[model samples]
Target: MTDSTAFDWRSFLLKWSGEWADSLPESETRDADDEAARQARWLGFPPASEERIAAMEERLGRQLPPSYREFLKVSDGWRNAGGFVWLLAGTGDARWHNNESGLADMYAEHLDEDSGPEERREADLWRRGLQLDVESDVTYVLMDPEDVDDDGEWAVYTWSSWRAEPPERHANFLAFMRDMHREFHSLGARQGDTGPVFANDTTRELDARVEEARLAALGGGWEQAEKALDEAKGYSRPRAAGLGDQIRRLLGKTYMVYFEDLVTDPRYTPELLPPLVAEHARHTNWDDATLRFQLRGADDELMSLAFETLDQVRNGTYRYTPAGPFGEAVDRARELARWGGSDAAWRTLMDALPLWEPLGPDHLAPLAWVADPVLGQLLTPERGRELLSTPRAGRTGTPPSPAANLDPGGLAWLAEPDRGNNRTSYRFVLVEGVHPEELPGRLTDAGGDGGGGMNGDADVHGADTVLNAPMTLWDARHTSTADQREFSSYDDRALVAVGRAGTDWSFAFDDRPAPFHRPRFVSPAAAAGVGTRAMVVWSGLRPGHRKPFFHLSMAEDGAERYAFTYEGGEIRRSGEIPEALEPTRFFGDLAEGAAAEAERPLLEAVTREFGASLPRHALTSGRLHTFTTRSWTRPPGQGETYTVVRRDPPPAQWTTGGHP
Candidate 1:
């Protein structure tokens, strides 16, 4: 979980010793130095008696692996003393299956090629040392496994560890495992098939090899093994050595089948599992666009397979959480639901996603992708034009799209209407939810779908109530304004007139009100119902200012002010401040010469601090002001307002609330 926790495969192997044959006892009678003898000793594959077989099946509540049935007859060559290996049969040629590799053909090529057994023994020892030399921390060296050919000649397994020509085998194996893991991973990725579904070609070949091995046992090549398997397991417990001999000879014929399956058809995908797939299945049909977003893959390589997996969930191949952000995997599925594949694949993927989390606004963007009006803000301006348009953009920037960004654009929306004395003033409100209520707003690359605070400020106004009509907000830092001392601007600010884009931004200037638009703006959520949270970053609180003050409170009956804080109850604001409002840029200190002496008139200090923020000073009531309003809303059509917190003396403060 920390820097100290980087993984070590060696440590993992050491810890997992139980999963290997390390616990098995060695046979002292055989030459420990002999490779053939040592392999025979360890590979005591024997058939279970009938009673034991039944008991094992009953215990596991499943059929025993068929590979164990063929190791019983006496003729099966199992011990090192025996000249033949029953598993390989005579000449080691796997019937119908290509065994033209390794020892199978080598032994046949020149049975007398090596004169003495000592030479063979030494060579085997050398190889064994390479696989388990604890002193050197050395594991098996990568080498090609030798096999037999149809013509009974020796050949090397193309990608066997002993031979390393094919580097692509690892990837192929990984793909196979990933897909197979979907099927039989006990955790329940697959339930109905009772087997594995490997994707990679290597695993497919591996599966074939295993079956070939099993078929060998049935073909009488390992007669002893078949006889051993036919005996009742419980009755033959004491004769294990004899039974094991038969089984060992048949192992090459049978066990290989099971081993190959383990590597090839591993259970990895949820389609092989259950219950979880059941939940995700809903996304496959795609009634809920939010769910579709969670099924798409990061890369396209797995899209087709992923889509197929989704179909399995829909078609009953497997079952799992159909949709959710519950666990890491499920959460990812939720994301893919919107971005999984090509149009058609997406439908399949969407339908396959199971529901793991509750449906709400925060999930809509990923669900709808650019279709989500709010998150569309994340696209680069060029991308935004491309994604938010109807026809999309052409290569030459010619009519990129016929549509506009329609989702939540991070502007703090009003949850309710304003109650005002003048009946003409405006108000602001906040969305009612667990998320914090906002005051300041900005346009940024992050959280455009209303997840976090808006990136910039609400200063792009097109004069009085017509807050910058085009409503285009760019997320930049390091900007200044007329009341530069009062508030810091974005690194850069972009302004555009309402309903007008393309080089027409007369209102793109200093101190413009951004939220006071005359024409009502609709949120993307309103359009799609499901959506994400939008965090607004719009506030210029002078440092050390105490809040909870009703002057800017929306609850008060100042009509417009009353209309604004409709849901202020839920809007999270800094509890209180001791000093006046200072933008975050100043931190806890005032600019040079601004603090001045306490004896200096507070108005002058205010002037130095706020510059030209207000027309009047000294907190005088003589400055009658009109309160403006803004709104905040979530998806599925709901809204309210908040009384704009501004100074009556012109360039006053508008503190949208959230902690710095």
Candidate 2:
């Protein structure tokens, strides 16, 4: 079966296995004794003989520990139904496995219309939760690109939707993403603030500032003066004397916005801007636009963190109480949900309030997601009416527009008037972050008083729908940014600029499941620092009495792969791989692993763009692959900007029709 969504594995595995296992009945429930007997069979005691165990191990190319091989016989039927199992070709660790619908496509290659008993028996290992070797659907992997930790802790491995952003499994992934984002934020945040942040009043401010700056320029022909502008670049600066000086004011404004101390400082030089010019920042407005544009962008960057925090409050995703960034945003979101906005938006806000608060016995924050099915519960039928009833935030505000002067009190205030009555509409963005997949056939299905922008058409169209149905995961992971507003002000069907698809996939601690893998996706440096060193190795496949057991480890670079195998239970470094083991097959076994390692560095803005289904006309999605590491946590003294994508390509450009 081909499972279109790769992200569904966790839910699918737990759900399908729990149900399937529950269906099986025990013969007598004496598992302890039965386990021993089963091991005896597998180990070839009477049912299993030492000679049989030795012969079986020989065929597999390795000897099994008496304890491990014994336990396999009594294995608990099956509880897992996805990842790393006996499939047609590759024996897991690297190849892809399609469950729902994709599984049908691959299996069709080896089997007839139906699977036989032997196929079913082989499949049982997966269902019963047997060993999970890595699978090749690796999104990305990598070793530390810089300093190699001799202790071997610097490396990261991660995977996600292919459609998602590129994978980034490297030695220093966690540290790397953070290092990159800080600079990304410091510089990019200004772009949104000055250019297009969805702040309180975009149009009015832009218009007002533009006019003021222009007038100042027209009057002062040769005099330099400082002024701010809201139009175009989004900020104002002191114009130098003369007409030429006035026009370049916004450029100066942007410079100051990016490096606050630079322009404002008593002694700053024009040389600071030279670097930008060399990087193709034409005319200087580049500094202004890039800086402010990214402030709003931060919203997008942090939205996932916010949803994750909210999810924890919603789903209890972790065992320990998480005091992470997700927690902070929930507190902020709850505050936003309670905020009563201009007349029209109030109802939507109030209706979404319940989804805002905490609930469920597990106290998991995500259970509120269950309420998403019945969005109708969020509305009060009088919310839109109520916005009009509440007094404005700070009086003295202008009425929405001469047309919407429906504000009989004349004390009306709308967030934006630029698109007033034009095809565009505005609403306080935060309410319920509706996932597109979760959207009902119609807006009313969620909680519509009838027109909160639902055009009543069978097919949904235009920018208007976003106000009524905002999505968290869809909105969060669907776009990329230097800051959070990119997510907050997101109006299009965006693609996320995740360092890697996400922080979900990880490296196992000791090849055992308990402390299986730390859920935290960290930097390669941290990974190597974590203590356990599970190497890549399998032995005894060749003749001349090669070692039969192998242990795993890596060199400083994590590039040249090596293993330590066993000869009579003693560990020895066997630098060379066995002759019998095919190099292609060996790499195939670790297809998942190597891919994960290779993808580490590329994850910055490559992964996390997966599974994004958007209309062609709305937006052109793309990746910011030129991420140059920059963050407060990283060592000072930069080689290249961590946030800046390709120096030449710039990575700011996008593609249409879902082209990569």
Candidate 3:
């Protein structure tokens, strides 16, 4: 690390110029009349003479801070210190902030009784501090003489109107400037722009250090590599930022690295992305970090490759063979995978990660098995908890468990009383051997509305009349809208949304109240006509109902195979129950407890028996094709009692085609 006392302002400003010039808009560069095109733009003004510096200090009746004084001796003032700061004031222009702008008084008037002591202190300092920035966008840079360190270095602050509460404070002027430099690089990177490279000693040295770090990582000197990359990033080197991210991913700080100019370079993509994509596939929820791979401007072919790899993983066809020093440990994992010990294989690979080293800067071995077709499925909620609960090399504490974030497959979400909208009631129909695309139309027909106006001609009445028309599957925008209304129940006119569960199974979600709430009302004919097995599951815990109820009805080929409804600690069973229900004690005498206690276990047993699962996201946040059903009309009597159980049923004022 370089000494702060002997900081090289000239070299730092030189690097700042390179970044500034590169970030200038193309239109500005094209116009000769633009200030950036007229002269040596972004370069600092000539150094202030000692006499001038002394005169300014004498006028202010205070000695200037050492770092700021040295900075003026090198460059009187700088243009474009960072993207947010347009210019720094020179000796001739610098003044006390209060003298020019009475911002302290303005802020004081707004302060209330709730304002804390820190806020008051900050407001007072705003009046006394020496302002450094002459031009900026709602941003101020000031040095406070009252808050000096032992070395006479004044505290520096960068404040912006958009920020909340306290401004960012740094130990000294040098620290503040360094942070600004880093911000410039981060801003550029986020905009998908890598600032122009300068072939100066400073940049050349940083680039060399990056290369050395790569070599160190390749040779298993991971700690050394991490240190070098960390140092390089302090200078805001774009390549170092990308490489540092990669090291963090490998060292377990994160599960993936994002796409960046350097990280996604053809030289690195082949090694870096395969394992990252694999890690992504293992996740139940695609959080922002994992979803960034599909952002605009990402490599198209790489994304295609990621999707194809995921398909292979799901189909149990993807394979990987580790090479070099990592080969032995990874091969052991592969053996475990082949022997059907998938969870063991994942644990084995995770255990060897600390010792495994990259074969080359562009070669990431061993980790590719994370995307291995069979092994990827091994990262269940249980394994995720285990991985997160254990501290890894170089990590300070146990990592946060992603277990809760992991998708609890099948009907697991039903047991969570506070899940999406917290309506305390859920009804869904699961069908096997039906394509997701075909379910909406089939469900429409089953609702007995002559295909629910899928041809766009059937009369429909609801908040979203367009539901009668076909829509694209996985409508992300609509899903996002639904997710935002977390506290509001679905309107009475709401219908069903369909999504795929497994390779050959589809499920429908209905959030409306009864008599539309029953899965039987939605019709089993849809599943039977297609000669596929289907199951309808319903559970309600709304207060004041005669009893909280759990219902399951299974149908195969136009016939009811088995059915049961458990309410108020009583269960009614009919037809031939599957053997899977026996282990769950579904038919045993009721225990003296709440019926809700047995709901989850029964749902799990049914899910296992039918080999069906619905992604929680599909119901909570994911968008799916929607359809309106003829649920408004009562079906002809089928020799079974139909009851409207909700205390707040649809208003009698609403017509239901003369059916009551």
Candidate 4:
């Protein structure tokens, strides 16, 4: 790290010339005249004569700042100061910005009472500041004489139109120039130019420090590694920036910074980006959690690319093939996943993690494991932490079993199987005497348009049309309303798949099956027509726990007939308990035990009595008409909140079954 106060201008300019000479490709260079001048002044021209400098100072009526004066003595002017700057002005070309630019007047018009102190200073300085850059790509570099420090160094400012705020301030000219040099190296690295940016000794020292940090991080000395890497980054060590980010991620300080860099790198894009995107979708699209660090800086083009790539991954059109033994492990894991053995698949991957080598310095093998399609879904936060903590050798144990098949006939596979982790909370609205085709229109305020939907099947139309209408309605509702407080309250938007069960039954399945404070039940007025009936069944349980609080509601002829809730070994009934519901019959051997065991029984009884049986194949493997339900348009009434007054003693059945 060179001290900015003692900056050596000649030596720095010499180093800059070596780095910038071939940093950019031929096509990226300026026109012939500009290129020739840039080459001629690459290391800067001869020193400015003291007589000539004094004459220029007299002409401008102001003495040059110490740093700029010393810089001019070493080089009259510099070329290609950085990626954006073309040339620095010598003593002859330097003058007050007000003499040649109207930027001050333009900025003055935008100032108001709300303008901050920094903004006011920026506007005032633009007119009186000494302009230094002769040419740039819409960038202005200036030195403010009024903002001098005790050392007599004027504060430097760099203003660019692309920035959102006022000009950025630097402590001195040396600081500004150092930043520009780092920018050149950063841009060069991104454009596939990985040449050395510093002297041989400096480069060797930084590289050695970065390698030590890497080893320290792998050895669980993350705090020490992070400190060393951060220090190296100040000298513009490219590997230091990446390794520092990896350390931060390992420490859980950031979520996607390292992965974000990997996705933009072409070397890892094919092998890693897809799984990373899939993992991001699992958190954003499927999980109940709000969107986090996924695609934080992505523009429209990148978002589109990610969305398309995810769709391909989900549809089995895209596959990631790792190299060596890791590829064989992934292949076996994927095969096991195909056969519904999620636990076994995850175990296989975990077993192979120790032998897996990252494709490049930027790659983290553990991230690839947690982001995998088959293995990622089964991984818990604890498991992810373990993987990140020990990147080379992940901990292994007996993983939880895959989600239990809830379909009555055991034929229904999940449409989005990755969501199976959340199957403990399930909800679906069942309607009698409504066709699957007609059900979407009744459930949503907007009628269906016969068009293909997001499921990638043209014939499956109503789901997309129905769901799209509600999003428009929600947007309009929030936009048109005076009170926007309820906007976030209407987060009940859900993906629903509509399919015919038996001859007389049709059901709409909520893809966000997780139970909430208010279940997104179809409005009785919409589902129950002249002679039709609608029923909603929900079970909210934690994974690996059988003590679910079950809810069943039935309505007929636009009137709710009965509601039954079984929770904490007690049954809360409204209206009347139907004779058809015989808990003892379904419970069978466990009839005398805890009510926690009643979930499966209740589901079985409801399936038998209502004749509600959705097609497993249609809901999973085959495409069915699906729509997104906008619960905001017709917000459902908050259902009853039950108090578990009766706490049953632990039953031997629950103990033997390992259910809590």
Question: Going through the candidates in order, what is the number of backbone clashes in each?
Answer: 177, 152, 0, 3
Off by over 4 Å in 4: 18-42, 45-66, 146-153, 160-169, 183-217, 220-271, 275-309, 312-362, 369-660
**Which tens-of-lDDT digit does each residue in 1-660 have in candidate 1?**
321123242332222222112222343243443444344333222334566546544643443222211221111212211111112221111122222223334434443675577445323322221110111111111112222223222221112234433311211211222222222222221123433332233333333443443333323223333344333221222222222222332222222111111111223222121211233453335553333343322234434444555454443222233333333443343232212111222223223323223122111111112111111122233332232221111112222332232222111211112133211212112221211112112221222322122222322321222221111222111211222333222112222111100111100111233332212322211111113221111221222222210111111111111111111112222323224422222222433333212112322332232221211100011101111222222212223333334444665767543223
Among all windows of ten consecutive residues in candidate 4, which has the lowest summed lDDT? 651-660
Ranking by TM-score: 3, 4, 1, 2
| Superposed Cα deviation of residue 55, candidate 3 (Å) | 14
Q: Which candidate leads the pack in TM-score?
A: 3
Error of 3 at 369 (Å): 24
How close is each model in CA RMSD to the real structure?
25.5, 36.9, 12.1, 16.7
The number of residue pairs in model 4 that clash at the backbone is: 3
Predictions in order: lDDT: 0.24, 0.26, 0.60, 0.59
**lDDT of model 1, residue 653:** 67
Mind giving the per-residue lDDT tens digits that candidate 3 earns over 1-660? 325558998888777776556565554434432365224644587899999999999988899988888889988987666677777888988888873566687668878999998778778878899999898988889899898988789999888877764678999998888887767655654554333333445556777998887655544455676788787776666566566665565445554355344535666555555656655655734453444543334577866766676665544356665555446767786554432334455667667655554434544223454455434444444553344343333333433333343346666666766544545677777778875545554454333442233333322333223333222223322432342322121223226666566556776666544533333444444343357777777777444456777777778776777777766666677788877775238535555445566667777887777777766543554333466443433354544333332323343232222123
> Local error of candidate 3 at 88, Å?
7.8
Residue 587's lDDT within candidate 3 is: 31
Please give, for residues 351-434, the per-residue lDDT of candidate 2 as tens digits. Answer: 332333222111111212112211212223132223222222222222221113122211012112222232121110000122
* Per-model TM values vs. the true structure: 0.19, 0.15, 0.50, 0.44
Task: Pick the winner on lDDT between candidates 2 and 4.
Answer: 4
